[model samples]
Target chain A: MKWEYESPRKAYGETLVELGKEREDIVVLDADLSTSTKTAMFGKKFPERFFNLGLQEQNMMGIAAGLARSGKTVFTSSFAVFATGRAYDQVRQSIAYPRLNVKIVATHGGVTVGEDGASHQMIEDIGLMCGLPNFRVIVPVDSNEVRRVIRFVAYEYGPFYVRLTRPSLPNITSKDDEFIFGRGAVLKDGDDITLIATGIEVSYALLAAERLEKDGISAAVVNMSTIKPIDKDLIIKYARKTGAIVTAEDHNIYNGLGSRVAEVLVENYPVRMLRVGMPDKFGRSGKWNELLKYYEMDDAGIYNAAKKLLEVKK
Target chain B: MSDISPEKIRELKLIANKIRELTIKMVYAAQSGHPGGSLSAAEIFAVLYFHEMNVDPKNPEWEERDRFVLSKGHASPAYYAALALRGFFSEEELVSFRKLSSRLQGHPSLMVPGVDMCTGSLGQGLSAAIGMALAAKLDGKSYKVYALLGDGEIEEGNIWEAAMTAATRKLDNLIAIVDRNKIQLDDFTDKMVILDPLEEKWNAFGWRVLSINGHDVVQIIRALEVAKEVDGRPTVIIAHTVKGKGVSYMENTAKYHGKPPQDEEEYNKALKEIEEERREI
Candidate 1:
């Protein structure tokens, strides 16, 4: 897989513009992060349909639900911390409980937000969003997947929380790859072990696979983007076939892709699995790439986890 | 108020008393619901369903129909009574309120017909109502959006945030009614959290503020009628009302905020008060 990085938020903003042109009922709301969330593109195109609620994530969520009740597909954008954390109760009570058609495409998921540190880095957004009933959570891997997920959630009638990273993702999953809602996309097939990943870590898993094979361990890479209504069959299938598993994400090891994957395997087909993500702790101000390496969530992290799992397998 | 006829005033008063009667009955029967705030909001609901708003109970999902959000959602008894009287749902469904497999949820929800938005979580419904108002403007629909909020519920910061949105967007089609009954579950609203000069707060938020006697059927209807005429800005009615207005013992009492009738005597007494008021009307 070629590793050319691209902004998922940019794709989100651009895709929203395209969707706005097609569907007149599609309205966009941003809580003062339109430029960063890339919702400014849609706002620039459709001024009347766009609302900048100005640092009011909680109120913005309620507005999103209200518009949805009135038969409009509403998309809301903000940093993940404020989007999911600040307005969690609003999302839970207003959007998720009623099952309104509001898409909360939060940018800056995980520690990739960087510099702003622990407060802005929302590593638990996926867990928070997935905990709610009627909320379908997705963390798109790259720019292509981001576009597809945004477009998909618009037509699908329900509440959605699509997590995107602040840093552009390295191109790993191609545009041609089929993006299914509740199914994991296997980027590479291998028999030795399966490397399951999501969001920015999908590219890291693919990159780690290259290093793993050179170390004589053939690794399979699967992008488990949909966190809720997770692809249990895929996890079970890969768990049985490989006999060992390694999960990676840009989120916490708890209740994220790893925890979810472990839950599925433990109930169905248990395997020797290693979770490669942040230890349960807060992150400090640093460069995002340096932070990824410091947290050991880069290619070397997945590669090292795979080798350790293989040793245990032996 | 003069323009509203004696017959129409008499009918609205009867409906308001009926709403109060049904509210107390529903709460007392459930043995687990709010009656104080619901009682305070009875006349507001009565005027909305019976006189003020443009809506069709037969077609609850009518796109052009005016929308209402019960922002202070625990007050479902009064709202349900008004909707039932207006034919949104059968009075039989009132028994199922706050029950399992019942469309009448503890708070207003989309499952119930004529409930424009699911609300109960304080301070959020106004924003949803603003969304409905904004949608109407986008679609070029003339239907207005109304939301009933508790004075206590406004203590939530989200209400202020939502207030900013309503005025910033100049949502003239939006009108919010604050059930200023003066008592919350814990204590009188001023004792719990001072919300005095509340109208000035809404005024500072750039809303067209109206103050009226919330319990008076004529005043409630007249205020609502005035609210619709205000142009280019949203309206917020600071309706002065007594907590637990109808029943003698419950009036202005905090205990009834989350309690039902304790005994048959209390229930019958409450019922008699409601019935006597109906007779006078």
Candidate 2:
């Protein structure tokens, strides 16, 4: 099947415009990076509702909380590092503690934020957001799912954290695919090993599954987009069937997708698992593809991890 | 804005005295809470709740009503006293200030009837007020937003960021009151971090700056009225007040900043001082 590449940030910006037209209560805020985060698209359409709070991520989060408290559905955007790391306390006390109706759609997540180095790339955003109570974390696989997730969180009345990558990704899911909030999407079915992935790594997992098929190893691919409130039933079903699992993500291996899946498997059904992601180290200035390859988050790396998991299962 | 009458000033002063007494009693009951800042801002709270703000204790969640955020959340006793006196809740609940099951926590929380935002950490409430003011402009509502900050709380960098945004957006419907009580948890505010030239700083940030005596009800009310009439840009009222205005023993002392009365003799003396002030008014 032929696939096209699209930017999730662009999709998020377009969806915000659409949502603005539909709901008058929807307000968008950005901390001086609207162009990079693609919130400038919404700003152009609804200048009255878009607030440009220049370079103040902490104050932006607090303002988002206050807007939500006044019955406005607020969508705030910034770089992943600033949104999660710089203003974490504001997010916790103002948004998460009170459970305000705010959507924090952070862009440039993970090592895909190429050339910006460790300072800009946020590999621990998932862990940071997931640590907060009443915050639902979502990382869409591609631009198609980004639109669905945006629309979903717009109407939903609660706090949420949606992460978007900087680099464009291949469209893996179709337009007809349903984007459920907490449910995982199964792209392929197999019995030998299960490959659970999220964000841009979903496409890499699919490529790894194809390679594993040639090696006489059936690899099941599951898109665990919603990191918090994770699909435990789907993971257990795949664990019972495949008996081996490999989790992939464009994040640190410690407290991200791999850790969540390992927690689920250990509690319900014990299975041989391997985590394919950035090891415990900061990323340097490099190209997006080079960073992924260097961190062992590409198709070849995922395939190797799956083979290693299969060997451990034997 | 009309001139405040002598009777109105006397009434507000009495109310401020009652609020101070209530604050001392609540802190004494809690045995662990901020009393210095709370006592200092009693007049500010009384004027805003009883005279300036367009709030309804009966309908606490009124859509078009004015909003107040206690940025210096440790001074929640003052806020709770004002809210209770305004009939948002019973004055009897003041005894349950920091109890586990009480609606009144150590800081201001939204679970309380009259409170709009949950603020315990410093330098956050002003940003929330800016958001509320912006929302009113977007929705075409006439409601105004107000926030009160401690003198020491302005040391946080986030406060400056929010101040700049509030000015840049030209939030005329927003008014911020700085309770310049001159003391914090550790020591005097100037000793901790010199916020002198504070009025000049606000003027540079593009806000209409007003300096007033925070312990004077008439001055506080007049400043709020003038702030409402100011056009285009937001207003900041720098209210100079003693650390513990009514209590002679605790006045200008950081010892009572976050500590309650030590024993019976101290508590009685504080109560007697406020009661005498109320009678004099």
Candidate 3:
């Protein structure tokens, strides 16, 4: 399935409004970025349920924690940079430690928030959020998958961190497919190498598998969307069958999907692997596509990494 | 306001003395708890727990019961002492201060029946208190919310943001008490960062201000009574206090802000002084 036109953040906002109508307990809190984060649509319809907390992200997190303590399901929205980085302690202590049912809806993830510069991009958010206990970290591949996640996180009992993107991307999953937590989607299968990816990198991995196949290299593409409670069973099964793995993501290599995949394979099925992500450096201000290519987060980078891993396996 | 008899004031003072003694015992036993702020906050906690607030210890979660948040969580000794004395928990629980897996943690948590919010991070509790007050208003319940803020912790930006929200919402059911002991962790709040003209600031922020001698049994009770009368605006009871009020060596000292009482000799001496004061009462 392919999206006609829609960003993952927009999909999240629309789905939230639908959930708001179904549940009276659902409330949306924005730190003066409702329009940019795409939560303004939900705010417009569910005006009473929406809270514009001005530019105070730290206080907004505290307010959401308070509301959650009072038995309200809260979704706090802001740029991932500020939401996770600036208010990290408040989220850690108030929301995450208490295990509140607060959904941390962060938009403008990774280098996708182009032209606004490195300060706006949040390549380290997943790493930061996943380190906290009792947090479910999710990064949807596209708008369709994000719709599924919006419903899943809203009804979930504990704290959640949903990393959404600012730009539009092609939808990769069909509506009828069942989206399970901690389960990986096997988009395409092959025999030689397993390409495990998460978030926006999932689509790139799919495209890279296609390119690899033309050169007689069969590749298996697995979308490891849920990062924290990662689908280790799938990664191991695919690694045993394929014998080599390539992990890719639009995040840092230190604590993101790459690190998670390596941890699983090293413990279970020891296999040759290659990790592709930011090379431990700050992102620069540029067009999103140009930055992706510069940071080696493109299909070509995945294909090249897979080729190198194949060499080690042989 | 109903007049509190002098005998009742003496009785409340005895209760406050007992709380201070228990607080000292807990910190001395734990060997790693704050004593200064806990001592300074003792009288205020005594008044709130014994007289000002409408709370049933047997039913800690009673819907209409008043809520209190200890924003300055380092002063948990005083809060735990008050709760234990008020029958929220067993007195034996105080012995397990800062111990692993104990309900009496270094900070107040909702796991304890009487605690309204899990607060340790400064400048965040007022917002939680405001939320509780908002919930009470929405539910048409007349329950009040009280939050104790440290004079030093007021420098945090989130506290001001919450102050703005509370006044804008006209949370008259919410009352904030600033434990104005004037000392922070390392130095005097005035030396570290001046929060002088604090009364004017709260007044400018739309909160009705009440100044009182925090340790005066009569004045704390009077301030709280006046706070309840003001409708349509949040009330701030600025209670001026000596950092370590009861102990002679520790009085007005920032060094005692987070330090526990020393050896058995010093502990016995402090206990003797408190006992002598009680005997005079």
Pairs clashing in candidate 3? none
Tell me the lDDT of candidate 1: 0.91
Candidate No. with top DockQ? 1
Residues A1-314, model 1: lDDT tens digits: 65778888889998999999999999999999999999999999999999998989999999999999999999999999999999999999999999999999999989989999999998888889888999999988889888889989999999999999999877676788778999999889999999999998988899999998887878999999898989999999999899999999989999888999999999999889999988998988999999999999999988988999999999
Query: What C-alpha lDDT, on a 0 to 100 scale, does residue A268 get in candidate 3?
Result: 96
Model 1 chain B: ten consecutive residues of lowest lDDT: B1-10
Candidate 3 lDDT, B166-263, residue by residue in tens: 88879999999999999999999999988989999999999999999999989999888888995899999999999987887778999888777778
Off by over 4 Å in 2: none
- Comparing 2 with 3 on lDDT, the higher-scoring candidate is 2
TM-score of 2: 0.98
In model 2 chain A, which range of ten residues has the least summed lDDT? A1-10
- Model 2, position A229: C-alpha lDDT score: 90
